[model samples]
Target: MKRVTSLLILVTMYFSIACQPTLEETNSQLREEVIAVHDEVMPMMGKLKSFEKQAQEKIAKLEQEENVDEARVEELKALAFDLNKAYDGMFVWMRQYEVEDGDKSPEEVESYLKEQLVLVSKVNEDITAALEKAERVIGA
Candidate 1:
């Protein structure tokens, strides 16, 4: 019975040590992660712009072609609009965001960074979806 209890206590202590993150570590990791997400998505804005231009050129060429499908052209236009919106959303968010610093407590900074991670994740999702839709449209 004594051996079993000792083993159990050892295991619990090991797990607890492994599972816990210090507040500073959490803050730093979350901040780096959120910035990485933003960096990953930032280049997509320029790609979106390029896609928009290509789409416009394609639409123009289609218009010159006889028997063009107006509905298809309209769909491309809508996709372009959405892509622009996604790009703008990310740019605006970056412009508006401020870094948490020494003025804030570690807990407050961690909380702020965690919130930013969610926001940046959402922006990344939006940009990815927009890029995928634009690619499909361009391919079609």
Candidate 2:
């Protein structure tokens, strides 16, 4: 009976160890997820650029004319700033991001990847929110 129990315990331990993912695997998966989020929002760059141009044009028009709605001009200025901010955020993230698999330990790599995931996710949110607001502002 004791032998059978020991065998069962060994089998469970073996399976558990075998099924667990390595840190490298975890980091790779995290890297893929981060890139996926970035990719999802990347196409919005062109839209952001277009909206920035439109907003600038509108602001310029409003500024040149007398009795122009100051509030509308201000709103467009803010939106244009946010659009550029989001656009720059993505570029900043891409520029600073690095894959450290050689000098860093697997655990360190995983941690770095996790941090990157959060950063990219925030960038995605910023881009998404800015784009949505821009669309509404322009469409209205």
Candidate 3:
């Protein structure tokens, strides 16, 4: 009975030691992955924040101009519609990253996300131009 008990203890100790490294390795990999994700996501968040600030400034200006040019209202309406469509598309692109981040490999997902940055930047440029044109019309 004593030998059986001792043998059982030794086996348990061996298994525990053998299993520990696998768990630690998995934990370490997950930590690295999380850090990588943060590195990628933080910059994009900053860009989005800057874009939001610019948008807010434009909207404030637009509100100030609302009473100035009653005649340009139709043009403003079209610009607003275009702007909304562009922004909705941008939101969808961002959401796609959120959905695919875990399922796809990081490199593959990031490549696709990079394409979205170009598209979003282009849309932002278009919106900026439209806002500027609208403001000019309002000022006139």
For model 3, the superposed segments whose C-alpha errors exceed 4 Å read 1-73
TM-score-based ranking = 2, 1, 3
- Expressed as tens digits, the lDDT of each residue in 5-68 for candidate 2 is 9999999999999999987788889989988998999998999999999999999999999899
* Candidate 3 to truth, TM: 0.37
lDDT (10s digit) by residue, model 3, range 14-43 = 999987756435544554554454344434
lDDT of each: 0.87, 0.92, 0.53
> Judged by lDDT, which candidate is best?
2
RMSD of each: 3.9, 1.2, 12.8
Between candidates 2 and 3, the one scoring higher on TM-score is 2
Across residues 1-140, which tens digit of lDDT does each residue of candidate 1 receive?
A: 99999999999999999989988988889889999999898877889898888888878888998899999889978888888888888987898677747699998888888888898899999899988998888862
lDDT comparing candidate 2 with the true structure: 0.92
After superposing candidate 1 on the true structure, give the runs of residues whose Cα lies further than 4 Å from its correct spot: 1-19, 63-68, 100-102
In order of appearance, the predictions have TM-scores of 0.77, 0.95, 0.37
Quickly count the clashes in candidate 2.
0
Q: Could you arrange the candidates by lDDT from highest to lowest?
A: 2, 1, 3
